[model samples]
Target: MIKYHVRKDQAITEVKVSGHANYAKHGEDIVCAAVSTATILTYNALERMGFKDNLNVSVSDGFFHLEVLKPNEFLGYLLDNLEDTLHQLELQYPKYIKYQKEG
Candidate 1:
């Protein structure tokens, strides 16, 4: 299954995502592909918008993590968009993905 957790604290908002949906074979797993595409694009968009310093991100085999070093009014919108997208996916594919948000 694919899993993601969002944690928020006084100074930072952290997002951790890992695992494959395993809903299909590697190249054909649309769930995995959708997650990857959304994640990478969010990272790139933040960098393009000149907020790289305001955030930290890590990616590795089957995992992607993001930390908002500090919150910004605009950045929150983007982050929320990402979360909302994933939440929709989780709703539709409950057996393949899980999402949790906590303080």
Candidate 2:
């Protein structure tokens, strides 16, 4: 299972997505959604790039989770998109900084 916690202006959102393989013989299947509007923008950009080929997107103002059958390239695509989306979002809300702290 993957979980994401998104906060803005005192509003907090939590999102979780997970998947389990039927058996080791079968491949792992999974998809994750974020609890941020930035995530929706990322999804749209991905779709514009001809991705989201089999992905499903769902949302609500407070929280939302999308489910999709994991695809061969989805994970890499998701990572790249998230980075890009947050970069753009930061530009608009520069006061809110986001960075991964190295441990």
Candidate 3:
């Protein structure tokens, strides 16, 4: 299963995604693919918007972590989009994906 954890602190947000959905074979897992794409795109988008200095991102097999050191409205919007997407996926694949929020 994939476990997604989100944390909020003042004007910062941190997201940690780990594990595999295992809904299908490696290359055939749509859930995993979607999550991976969303994370990568979010990180890239933030960097492109001049948030590179305020962001920290790490990606590895079955793991991804992103920290927004100084989040703004746009950053929050992006994170909200990501959370919503993951929640939607979780609804469809309850046994393979889960989400949690913390402060």
Cα lDDT, all candidates:
0.86, 0.42, 0.86
The collision pairs in model 2 are none
Question: Over 4 Å off in model 2, which ranges?
Answer: 1-37, 80-103
| Selected candidate, larger lDDT, 1 vs 3 | 3
- In candidate 3 the C-alpha lDDT for residue 20 amounts to 97
- Tens-digit per-residue lDDT, 1-103, candidate 1: 9999977564338778899999999899999999888888988998999999998899997999999986987887778788888888999899998985554
| Every candidate's CA RMSD | 2.1, 15.3, 1.9
By lDDT: ranked, best first: 3, 1, 2
Among these predictions, the greatest lDDT belongs to 3
Off by over 4 Å in 1: 9-12, 100-103
| TM-score, one value per model | 0.91, 0.38, 0.90
| Full-model lDDT, candidate 3 | 0.86
Quote the lDDT for 78 in model 1: 78
Ranking by TM-score: 1, 3, 2
Q: Model 3 clash tally?
A: 0
